[model samples]
Target: MRRVWTSYAFRRILQSVFVIWLVSTITFLLMHFMPGDPIEIMAGRLNSAGMSHDQALATAANIVNYDPDASVWAQYLDFLKGLVTLDMGNSLTSPSKTVFDHVMEYLPWTLFAVGAGIVLATVIGLSIGMAAAYRRGSAFDHAMTSIGSFLTGVPNYILIAAVVVIGYTVLGILPFLDMRGRVTAGVEPGFDPVFFGDALYHAILPIIAFAFTATGSFLLNMKAATTEVLTEDYVTVARARGLKPGRISRSYVGRNAMLPVIPQVALQMGTLVGGSIVIEQILDYPGVGQMLMSAISDRDYPVVQAAVIILATSVVIASLIVDLVLVKIDPRIKTEGQDA
Candidate 1:
């Protein structure tokens, strides 16, 4: 068990490194392709009388801690140096804040909203799917499948649009979705019910929106996986051995059936964490995804890079987690001698 865990941990580290590399390179290149200079964007509010194109270019170069005329290799080395030291550079729009600082400011919003939403959705969907599958041909099973299939067909953003519009435009009951603003309008006091209550109150809409969009996917995936598991030969043999209904359902059916869903669960968790930018935007929740959008809008290269790197790291780590989970749940997956 120890050896297997060690092997999995090593692989996770390797994948994490690869994702970090990919994210850094892609972020750097994408920043290069952006329409304007980080320097101009950073200094715009302060320097209303902006610099010339040349000056703006120079300012951008300075803020990014790079010599504009330096060789690509030199810039690459500097970039790597920054990466190693965790120096994510500066945000052009919010010149006072480093990229890391920017993300730090907003990450918790997403953790509470989309992160929790995904977990909630997964738990609910997976449990219900298992139930539906086990009760196949029953009215409840048919109802769940029919409803889930209908919901799963719609794009998440469309759902987001419909729901947000209804709430904001027609009902006017909830605060409109806007990702950039904090619940307390800026202050986050520690361990106070007033502060926590305001935060939760604001979080209510975004959480529901995210849950609605995510639950369908979870349900569909779980149901499909469960169906496939039920058809497996072991399930057949479990019944042949005269296993009790509940025991066979749990030990043989649900456990083995959940193997495929495990990998997807990890990946979806990563996506929920990283891909909630749209939800955050609509709802005004301050998360990493919202930070990415802000960085892009403001041409904050460092902030954008930092956010992407965080997301990419999550994906790689999730994949590794999925691998380990599969091995843990089913010892037969590992090569001989891997299991004690």
Candidate 2:
């Protein structure tokens, strides 16, 4: 066990778990210490619906599965217990639904959009960046650099807004109303092509918005990395040995240049996931961000807490996976025990 502490993968897993626990705990504390009581707030709503104060209070407690009279520490323990059991209780506002149900319903769409966008951005960016690096001082290189700088400087929301305005308002080409949700009104989700196509159609705009800014960062980083790799002795030796340009670029340059940029993919994914809130709202898309916004508005504590924890956990896990991948791909990246 003591030896395990020095293992890099073990340390990363432990750190990820600790970070998630800390986030969930802080979210729990914030919810409890916030100005309003969730049970009281629910009770007030029930009272407005003609229930007597005492009846409303009792009903609210039962519905929320929370005892207002319990000590804060007791409640905190219960919260942690619920987490362990994967039971976040029922949603406060929509008492019929569990928080997990709500999160699961919407979380996948957000993940899809972010995942698809990052992948698209990384591929296109790396290719263009590599080409630009190879053609260092030419017009294409300068043009790409300027475009990348502009994209990096612009906020994703601004890009989203521009997309909406141009695609919907000016061009009159985009069917904004039809593209609002995850699928067409009557489409049942399944393995069918129609369902998949429609889902991608609705997701396209948000994906574009996410990919738009991320591409620039990837491009710039890949360009810089490729340029640096070009200066290395191995690359010069490969050229001196009369290797084909394509072989030298692919086997020697591209592979090495990608190392730095690969880690950025995880970081970019985290950023895009967080930014999904604004993008989803603007597009009126049904995803975790939209659900979180609605939960916060309705003071639905369980849903809010669950949504936050899920998002945080996704990011932490992405980062951990990237770190582990880096170790696997790059021999120079020494794990703690490897040093000995």
Candidate 3:
């Protein structure tokens, strides 16, 4: 048991768990410290819905599973207990649904949009970066580097704005108004092509925005990595062996060059997930980001807390997975950890 604590994977998993717990605790505290009282807010709505003041207060308290008379510490303990049980109680604003239900309903859309964008960006960036590196000092290489630098320097929101304006107002190429939600009206979700196609159609803009901003970093990094790898002795040995250019590029250059850029994928996942809030709002797509904004506006404490926890958990898990993958990609990481 003591030896397990020294293991890199075990330590990383423990650290990730700690980070998640810290995030959840902070979110719970922030919600509590916010100006409005969720119970009162719910009670007021109930009062306006034909219930007497006392009845509304009692009903709201019961529905929210929050006792106004309880000590703050007691309430916090209950919150933690609920978290442990995977029960975040019912939303103060939407008493009929649990916070988990709301999170589950909306999180997948954000995941789909952001996940697709990351994969597209990785492919485009890695391919272009490698090509540019091989042709270093040429006009095409210079052009690509300049474009990548510009893209990297600009904020994602700016890129998204540019995409919306150019595609909608200037070019009239994108049907901006028609592509406003996750699916067209009356399109029931199923395993069929229609539902999947329409969902992708609606998500295209957000995906493009994400990919556009992210591609620059990947391109720049991959280019640098590939350039550095080109000078290594092993690559020279491969060339001296009279290997086919394509084979040398794939086996010798591409595989090693990708090592440095692989970790960036996990980092980008977290960043894109956070950025999805504004992008989703601009695109008017129904996702967790929009749900989070709505919950914040309505002071729906449970929902807000749950959304934050979900996002934090995703980032932590991604980082953990990347850490493990790095050990597999470059065994030196695992060896170093064991030594430490």
Candidate 4:
């Protein structure tokens, strides 16, 4: 058992490294192969500021450490050097700012908005799903399944739009819900009550929009897993032993059923980092996903590459954690790994 665990741990570390490498390599190659030149995009901005096209192009190339005359191999080597030094280069559109700065500024917002949403969804979904499963084949169970399925089919952005229309435009009840930026414009920046309260207020709509979309899938997954767990022999034994219904539901069924949801929660958190792009855009919330979309549009290679790498690394690490957790939850996972 010890040997199997050690092997699994080592294998997971290597797999995580490979996943990051593969994702970074693919992003780099695909971006480089794309038709638009980041240099040109930069130069276009320069031209708008009155510089001649040829001169603007030359200046932009020098600023970004790119040489159109250089071989692709040489450019790739430079990129690797930048990566090693943690200098992800500069944004083409925003020449004065580095990709690292952009990420630091925006990544936290994504974490706040999407992270809160996923956590809420997991908690709510697990509770409701377990409850629904306890009354399997009842009207409540069927209704929940049907509603979850319907909501799961709708895209998150559409929900965001509908929420904006209904909450702000139609109802006007949430007057403090600012749809643009991370906080109210005049709020002092700090951990003070005013700032934090405003920040939370601003985040409410985006978080709700994201959570509403995320909950449905989690609900369905948890419902299925819980239903399966309730049918297991241990649950039957608990019932036969004259355990109280509530006690059996909580200790025997809920405890065992939650095992599957734990690893899934980790995986979902990873994907949430990338999946919140549309929600951010709609809400005008400043986040890494919003930054990434702008970078792609402006052909900001450094920002785009850095964002992709960060997201990929996040996913890989989360997946590794999930694997370790699964082994801890179910020892048979180690045996399965060994067999594979």
Highest lDDT: which candidate? 2
lDDT of 1 by residue, 113-218 (tens): 7666767777887888888887888999889888777666765556767877887789986466443355766657679888887777777766766666567776
lDDT tens digits, residue span 208-320, model 4: 87787568878888899889988899989988999999998888777778777777766667656767788788888888888999987777887888998887787788778
Write out the backbone clash pairs for model 3. none
Q: Ranking under lDDT, best-scoring first?
A: 2, 3, 4, 1
lDDT of 3 by residue, 1-340 (tens): 8788788889899999999999988998898888887789999999999999999998888888887788989999999998999888888877998889878999999999888999999999999999999999999899999988988888787888888899899999979999998899999999999999999999998898788777998999999999999999999999998999999999889989999898899889999899888888888989999999999888888898999999999989988998998888788987887878
* lDDT accuracy of residue 317 in candidate 4: 84
As a whole number from 0 to 100, the lDDT of residue 273 in candidate 1 is: 69
Question: Which lDDT values do the candidates have, in the order given?
Answer: 0.72, 0.91, 0.90, 0.81
- TM-score-superior candidate, 2 or 3: 3
With candidate 3 superimposed using the best TM-score fit, by how many Å does residue 219's alpha carbon deviate from the native? 0.4
Give me the runs in candidate 4 sitting further than 4 Å from their true place: 1-6, 47-59, 242-247
Error of 1 at 29 (Å): 2.3
- Candidate 3 RMSD computed on C-alpha atoms after optimal superposition onto the true structure: 1.4
Highest TM-score, which number? 3
Give the per-residue lDDT digits (tens) of candidate 2, residues 201-308.
999999999998899999999999999999999999999999999999999999899999989988998899999899999999999999999999998888899999
Higher-ranked by lDDT: 2 or 4: 2
Better of 3 and 4 by lDDT: 3
Clashing pairs in 1: 42-92, 177-282, 177-283, 178-283, 178-284, 179-284, 179-285
Ranking of models by TM-score: 3, 2, 4, 1
